[model samples]
Target: WNVRKTSNKAIHGVYEGVTIFEAPAKIGLNQQAVGYVPTDEEWRFPNFGEDTAHGREFTQSREGTFGGDNGTKSVLPEHKVWFFYLQRICNHCTYPGCLAACPRKAIYKRQEDGIVLIDQSRCRGYKKCVEQCPYKKPMFRGTTRIS
Candidate 1:
């Protein structure tokens, strides 16, 4: 279901008994360098049964067409292709590496929800947080020189 169609202000949804929440918008931030970061404009919903090039490659790898007797000549049937969609986001761990890596103490976790956030003003564009975060959630904005 498209949440924007229902309400632009809404940021949460339920799909197949799983609750999904939208990531906060990063206005004026060029997030191309960041790995798989979600924006308010784009929601990373699981697209099941989508026939993508990566899906085709995954199917071939699973069927052993690349290294087995088939070599590279075998093509798996379209109906036999099996792929699952995974939506990645910050796990908000009890011990956040991003928060711990910030020398300026720019990154902090909220006491209530435990949401990790980087204080932009205090951040000196030191990419320690970016390097330490396993999920690669905190991104460095080169234009602003802050992470």
Candidate 2:
């Protein structure tokens, strides 16, 4: 959402992180200090039909998908303001919610390695596990390659 130019809707400035502001949120667009949407998380330099590993579809997601927000909700500035920290992914969890949500009886933690896997043959992609998994780990891949 580089939005190199600004609009009245949601202005996603990249000067720092992807900072989205609602219609009411105002900023000087023509100013030299205009914000730039962070490219590290959301975009990758498209390699033009050459890099299969970095396909077009994959590059489309170079910018991380927006979640938990309704797209540029609102965040007013204040001298003594505090903002909610965004959630970032880390490997460990005390009570793994994903392992318990697989309905096919497919999910289990490895005794030796403590790893969990879903049996593709048994998975119906009903997304029951998607909804039930508290941690939101069971990603529902739309690609036929997975199912």
Candidate 3:
């Protein structure tokens, strides 16, 4: 709801590895439910397998939001289940991984707020900081190889 009010960015859920808020699901015996999410009324199944579950799986990349380079799809079990949403944010660690991984000394940790930041002027765009970040918060722009 906050996402809707703030930037109005489309909020998508990571289901079966893909970034999607709704997907095809099986509801009850021989009944098909289209575009299912945890918030949906049909998501709650009185009985397990007979009521609700996804019929097929659509695999997505670990960087699901960006759809990265590693997206894939596969089959998954069909059964009623409850999905839990887990949110991950930048930890702003005392010893920041991004700050430590920048070979060009481009990333820094602010003393006041302890927020990790990148110095774009010095950034060679090696994406070492992107790789080192556990939450995968750092983003690389322009090109991958760095001109």
Candidate 4:
């Protein structure tokens, strides 16, 4: 999950005749923009700056305002804003934290490929694996039982 470039060409990388898709789990934001405004779902690109009322604030404005074009009103103009996207993926360590922290032995590493996996049937929703995972890959999705 090492996606350094912002464009789609950098987001998905092809390796060994296989296309790899990177889904970012963490993002770092910096930079600034000028005269940028948000658009509604109906709005599409190449036709930007339409339907400003249908926009949502990325971060709360500096003055606690909902919509503004300048930095004084909001954090910064939309165009100047920059976000550093980082993708997180399992490293498949020799001794995985999720595998060790699972109380019910629900998590395991495959012998052949060394890929870590979870056995849902053995999981008791303890969430120890989720807490212990350094990369925060083991997420708790709530109970599967129906009442």
Task: Highest lDDT: give the candidate number.
Answer: 1
Candidate scoring better on TM-score of 1 and 4 = 1
Query: What lDDT would candidate 3 get against the real structure?
Result: 0.47
lDDT of 3 by residue, 1-147 (tens): 564465444467433541111111322123222221222222232223333343223222254322223553443444343332122356877556566566787877776767766776788876666666766566553323321
Provide the overall lDDT of each model, using Cα atoms, as 2-decimal numbers.
0.54, 0.41, 0.47, 0.48
lDDT (0-100) at residue 112 of candidate 3?
A: 70
Residue lDDT tens for model 4, 35-113: 2222222112222233455454433445645555554453333442112112246677755656656667678787777
Q: Measured by TM-score, how close is model 2 to the native structure?
A: 0.33
Instruction: Give candidate 2 misplaced runs (Cα > 4 Å).
Output: 1-94, 145-147
Clashing pairs in 4: 32-80, 32-81, 33-80
Candidate 2 worst ten-residue window by lDDT: 79-88
Candidate with better lDDT, 1 vs 2: 1
Model 2, position 107: C-alpha lDDT score: 56
lDDT of 2 by residue, 120-139 (tens): 77777655554555554554
Candidate 1 per-residue lDDT, tens place, 1-147, comes to: 664566645366534431112221322222223323333211222231144444423333455343333454555444322222222367787667666566787988887788877788899977777677777667555446676
Q: Residue 119 error for model 4, in Å? A: 0.4
lDDT of 3 at 115: 73
lDDT-best of 1 and 3: 1
Q: lDDT for model 4, please.
A: 0.48
